[model samples]
Target: MSCSSSGNEAFMPDDIKEKIHNHPCYSEGAHHHYARIHVAVAPACNIQCNYCNRKYDCSNESRPGVTSERLSPEEAAKKVLLVGGEVQRMSVLGIAGPGDALANPGKTFETFGLVRQFAPDLKLCLSTNGLELATYIDEMVEHNIDHITVTINSVDESGEIGSQIYPWIFYNNKRIYGKEAAQILLERQLEGMKKCVEKGILIKANSVLIPGINDKHLPEVSKKLKEIGVFLHNIMPILSEPEFGTRFALDGVPSATDQQQMEVQEACGMDMKLMQHCRQCRADAVGLIGEDRGAEFTKDTFAGLSFDELQIKYDLEARQAAQAKIEEFRFFLDQANERVRKEKEELSSDGHTILVAVTTAGEGMINQHFGSVREFLIYEAGDKGIRFIHHRKVEAEYCAGPDGTNPLQPILDRLKDIKLILTAKIGGCPQGDLAAAGIVADQSYAYQPIEASVLKATRKYFNLPEEMEVN
Candidate 1:
């Protein structure tokens, strides 16, 4: 879904609109065209959440708090220049970590300073637990860090639910635990968030939906976030796998289902603008939200590169021109998508919705082949319009050398609920398997804008006219 459809754009000020115009995580439309990079410069956290398990040199996992490598402020600055030069669409530089950005203020601010000096056009963002956020508001404003994300799970005030999620917190030079710790943390979070909002920084609150723990309580959290003038709220599913070693995972706290997440998002969305496209990116994540390219520019890749060489590559005018072209394409794409949304509303029948999956490598287009797809961006399409629901990650590419196992079966199983699959191309054998499984696979809309294509496909499947009157 695009940001304008949220119904918040009508009331949003011009400055806020400009701030999120090109920010991938902030704007749903920009995510396809723009990219962000997070540097793991801070490796220290103040609070302990039940769902967190920080790990280093961990390239296998894609969730938050996992980084393959940590860098100093100088190294991070150099890497930013290199990536910005290579990936011209890269626009934001965030310092979300294997730890809290606020916990290591020195490193976080230093990195922000260097980036500001060398690549002033790149927007700076920081994500934290909000423990030390109030303390660094001045520094944040000084560094021109206009975007901030705070993970706030509960707002129960009494600290009942918060205590269950957080076992302990190290505050005021002491380890505080239980209800008291939760209360303190919540107080600080609120105070800091309010201060940041007052400073005109766009705040996006992230809440992890733990099934039985705080699922029902999230609506209240969302309401409170909206009351504080938060720009967006993201309800993310808890990733509690046994191998990651999070406290909740070890205790068998099942992760939130996609349905459960959607339900909560529906409830919270009534009070706050919801962000449904988060990829739960890693600390050192690079490139687009759906794809990571950190390994392509590791420390060793630019070992001997000097500051002057990297700076020369960071061409501001060239980046601006490329971004302008992207904006021009999006302007036309948005007009096309708006027509689809209107057509969907007029072609309503019994409020029925069908799930559709698209194979994409970012840039908001169905550009990936079926066999090479590592992930499928799932969308719910119907008379209500197309909305992104989930990101399903497959274990391995279908074309990967087989170990005598039917790769097609796993792909089928994963997409069993899907009614249609939209991709760039599909093999004849796999296409047959998908058709036999009652799933329709289509490649006619290859590399097309995802939402318009999905809605058009949905209309075609339901026997509705592909085009509607432009009234």
Candidate 2:
């Protein structure tokens, strides 16, 4: 199933060409130019690899399963958009997690769906432990995820070698250990790889060159993967550090030297296409290989920020004087409504125009946490005055874990073409997000009537003309 250079025209499929053309991890030719970003949306693992310690994020260390932050599906999608804009060369959005992506299927697929909806051209990639490979292959294909990487350390004739590499595996709702666990994992991984191959999914097999453990057996592993139709093989060197804290911490396992890695890669290259440029990136890695920009988007850098700080970041002065004058605000609302009514009449004479969104509790009061609000009261803002359009439903209370995945994407999608958003309060990240979409998020009035907030926003923020101008 391996496509040699000589037989490239004969065996390489169209899907394979398109997938590898822009994917840096699979194509040596594209690595130097095109960029990729991996969003750590999945944080739950189903298998335990002895060499992997997913606890810390070390910048100096380059390996899979290490990330500075874990974002929710919506959060991941937002970051993907932000990063794509920031890095115009980015062509792929991958879900290579701090944990197994398949184990956290809900978040993984949700992130994929949101990103695909927004970025249809962006290539989607996923890396997994292969425990739940078969279970999710159909779904992955359905989502158009063409690139998948499976870490297969050992496929020894006996399960002894694999047993040393992986301490245990969680399968069938239970934990299996020792040789039996190794056998099950290997069988499943191979079966899953074969399934992915049959589905026309480009498979990249990653084998850890764990010196004494699986280094010698890698040729056999590579041969099996090639025979099973793996498109590429990546042999990664294990980082054996006691401070990293894993089962292999004090095992005295010597790290594979540069000479050892090259030699092993050469031997495996004969059987299959060897990926020599594997940087062993972290789960939340961004930008080009070896050029990590994750620090710019970390939770500490962007999360837990107040709107005041955000206003200062954008250099927007506090509207303290305007806010204090309740009478002026109320007057603006009245004039805004009258102007809106006239505008709507003109718009309805022809067609319709703009939409506005507001976060509020029932009975028309501006209340509810920006992160917790599950519904938005949408309105059609025109010269006819702001009229209630409908209620837009979203995921309720998305504040989960340190990296909270809000239903912001879906909410934004629902309130499409919205000119402004009136809310009691909003975080700095979301405020910036709204601003990017040309939607103003005004948190100037809290516990105020919804109509007053909407009217004030229309006249002052949205630049809607007053009734006097209409006259």
Candidate 3:
């Protein structure tokens, strides 16, 4: 998940390793099978791109910075819950825009915070112009936003080439144009890229290849991005259309040909990882990459439905799915335990068995915060390796009320057999409370696959001599 401009991938934490493969646009395996949805909650842009036309929305046309309807933070969260229930494979939720996501900071972050509460398992993603990205980098990380895509059209520090692509940028309550704006924008983008890498957040750098303008300069852009440890570089073809009313269209700049795109991609591939399957999706894109469902879930679809009605429907569907998943885990645990009975002694290191509880929302990944988890997946580990038991449901929620009372006591009581708790993060009070109950709390693991974390945890902490041999 972590890569550099040198074309070498360095070591990262386990959570980051699992998050990269879950994103459709970032991973080849995820792109084919996993589904993602983007909510158009941000409608204001801070900078102007030569190829972008914000007024056009054909529904048939698929490109960035275009959407038919803009939803408020609450409405967007409702739509995400609705779509997530229908598309069980939905693993990522993004806020791309009819405008820049960070430009509309209030609305964008409100929607992100809402989705975090609603669907903790869904990987939170955002795409920005990098003008305001550096300012919001720490806030984004606090919100558990792991996947970030920053569109840096040009990295020319001199602003000679960048001035042509971005004629003007609105920064600091002033409209700066020509070289001044370009210099400011380019400097901010590179600074933001460095801050992102320093914080260990996965970044995908996107550059729109404007033929005859910045086409030849993309290789340099890619090289600079790779030096910052950007995980991937996406070279997109610029779309020049008269209807969109852009300088590129008026100037008659031709769009990059298919062969031209491939050539640029191949060139960048030599320096770093090149992403080739970008669809240039709209801000309101839904469903798969090539197949967008934005039109189907337009504002008209929810004409008579109220927010309360949608909430009720979502709760019913979520409850059913939760119960079903719990039953499935119970059945699998029984079977796995039965199969491992014969090999139990061989798998055990010192004949010590312990239960480990992981905070997770989905079947595969540890994608939730400790305070947000309502259920913990329980696994028994020993010489026989690790086996799924049943999930432990907590009566008291972690952040439901004031922190004066011990809300985690009930959860700890329910997980009496558990010796270790693995979560994304835990507060100081809860950590102390858990230790008092003779349970070890580990907050290093987050956004990782359940099976992978379990295997590693057993080997490292449980002192298991041999690999886990489970069916």
Candidate 4:
């Protein structure tokens, strides 16, 4: 169904289409590419479009809907490994977030880092609304992630249909939008694509065809993108159905049917993938080519995994097996805990308790906040499933409770017999001071009060999900 936008120039000209099909990722969607796994990073989007019914998370699907579950980098890496192994050709690592990926740069980059380290040969790809792409080009380049997908609906901001789709966009909260803002955004996205091409990043576009809205504008989009060096355009058919709820509201406007979709594809020189396998999966969705889930995908089907599948009869047997391994070689940890308990028994005083400092910011800034803080050095001293040490800080900043003489010091001196110090906040100066004072600052706790320091410390903080944030 390949046609042309400019009165039929070269609908995805053979050379360009060959480039796309030759790409490591263009396979799964078509028969050429092997497999694709899209990670849901930032669940928050900047501009709102009409056709986007995807929940903040593509992983948050309803039935096969995985719109709710967002995995950490560690978990995602593990899942990728499992899926890649199962599918036998999961070469593309991608992120089709509910929002844009640039917003979740840390999570996206961290996850990418671990994945690259764990599985180096996999090809990485990311799709964004193109709002923040300009800010993250260097980062993507550093990570060697050149396969990019930018979803651009229309190039003409003044057009009636496009204006309706991009009615009011917000920039810096003031909302400098209308036809003007949409026009500006379109230009910025084009500029971003140019920069991407200059850097050797292959840009694939996803354009949602909403009948009268953007369907006619595909030609200009494809033409402009081609001039800007976009490798391919994937003109997507609008999947908004009334039954799918309020995701994409058409009001009285009907959607593009198979025939209309094909017609639009022919009009634009772009690859249109609405293959039967296109389940409109969640951002963090996972699955085999023709399978529903669990039997093939763990995303919507993780809970279905039972002990029987793991070859264990009961949960206790699995626990015992692991427990046996720990006891055989790592019982010394328990013995060490006992020793610390005995030492604490010697002091037994409330005023001599150690302080715990877990932070979201990194050590340097953490120290900037707390200064020369000292507390009991905590290590993996907790066997309660979470690692941490109870420590004391002698800084006015950390206590958020009190200031002066580091009141926690007396407690630390009392718990001189205590094993470790685990605080919710930590910085570099405090780390150095604590190190000298036999106080260890370990951050394994979830610090809700100050997120920056906490996230910086553990590199594991998810910028509070918007749905759960305080406005």
What residue runs in model 4 are displaced by over 4 Å at the alpha carbon?
A: 1-33, 56-68, 157-160, 173-176, 247-250, 270-280, 288-471
Task: Give a tens-digit lDDT track for model 1, residues 1-471.
Answer: 232223345357889889998899998778888999999999999999999999999998899999999999999999999999999999999999889999999999999999999898999999999989899999999999999999999998899999999999999999999999999999999999999999999999999999998999999998899899998999999999999899999999987766787688777777777887798999999998888999898998666798889888988889999999998988878776774442223335577888899999876688999999988888778754666666777778999836999888777767878999999999898899889999999999999888899988887878887654454
TM-score of 3: 0.65
Tens digits of per-residue lDDT, candidate 2, 131-211, equal 899999889999998889899998875789988988889999999998999999988998899899889888888898988
- Off by more than 4 A, model 1: 1-11, 342-349
Which residue pairs clash in candidate 3?
5-226, 347-383, 348-383
TM-score of each: 0.95, 0.62, 0.65, 0.55
lDDT of each: 0.87, 0.71, 0.74, 0.52
Query: Per-residue CA lDDT of candidate 3, range 1-471, in tens?
Result: 111121121244566557775587786334544678998888899998889887545675677878878899988988887777666567788999988899999998999898787677788999998999999987899998888999987878889998998989999999999999999999999888899888878898889988888888888988898888998888888878776677898889876765576567657666767665477888888886555877877766654566566655456456456545654653453343333322223435678777788886544556677787766766666645554443444645688834776677778667776788888788888889889999887776676555456656666675544245544
TM-score-superior candidate, 1 or 2: 1
Return the number of clashes found in candidate 3. Answer: 3
Query: Taking the tens digit of each residue's C-alpha lDDT, what string does model 4 give over 231-253?
Result: 65666666666755543555755
Best candidate, TM-score? 1
lDDT of 2 at 209: 90
Query: In model 1, how large is the Cα lDDT of residue 119?
Result: 96
